[model samples]
Target: MEILESKEQKLFARNLICVGIDKCENGDFCGRIWEPYDDQPFKFTGINEMVIHMDDLYDEWNYPQRALNERSFLRTHEMARTNIIRDDGFVEKIDRLQKMRGEIGTFIVQVKFRQHATWQGVVVWAEENKRGNFRSAMELVHLIDHAINKGLLIK
Candidate 1:
């Protein structure tokens, strides 16, 4: 994968949602997720939590507002990706990307498909320009963790 070292390099295809991963103070992965049309990034703490949140978001998006069971997904689908309505004045995509890259262990993620109760996507280690494919959400988290550890070692 190409390293997005310049401002002109678009993170992914315009359609795919791009997620930025940063190492938190306690060594947990902090996620900054950006949908296509939305300028504000949705922040999550751990990788596992982030995965679950994304799944919830997806479910809520595809289905009605009614909650299934006790877990309630945010009704953010209407505001995400779809450009029918615009509340925000301008897009801050570049700022978010730059912030992610400034972190200790930066990763750019683009989830392509969700099937069999898990995620399948590609992740890029920003500092090293390394790319990896994940078969499942667990695998995705493991890949990010491994990259963070490897980055620490390299430094």
Candidate 2:
């Protein structure tokens, strides 16, 4: 994770924003890494084209039978409510991270890219340095901003 730390240090040097993150009940400060795209095409793309309905969204995040080695918990939305909406700094912190990532869509892409690169422990750097060959992050931000302006809100 040294490379990730170094990147965060450079970001701090440039924007004075530290990469300090709070422990999330489910995932990132605002939501799961996929939460932003939960109501979008990306969700289906990741889940073998399964359309997530409202009923499925409301399902509990409980464990299976509450075994001795496992523990039950709240639903995804409930966790989001507690860890994101209930956290006063969640929105700002998420926005800042998005900015650090260059944009929300860019952030999503980077997350997936990391996932594909390392399979797990996404914080780990890839072996090959395919730097400066990716698509423009600002272009994606513009598209996302346009969609948001057109009354986009959680499908």
Which candidate number would show the highest lDDT if scored against the true structure? Answer: 1
What would the per-residue lDDT of candidate 2 be over residues 14-106, giving only the tens digit for each residue?
111111111222322221222321222222222112112211221222211112221238533432212222334445444444342312222
Clash count, candidate 2: 0
Clash count list over all predictions? 0, 0
User: Which residue segments of model 2 deviate by more than 4 Å?
Assistant: 1-84, 100-155
lDDT of each: 0.56, 0.23
Candidate 1 deviant stretches above 4 angstroms: 1-11, 25-27, 60-102, 152-155
- Predicted model with the maximum TM-score: 1
Superposing all C-alpha atoms, what RMSD in Å does each candidate have to the true structure? 7.0, 18.1
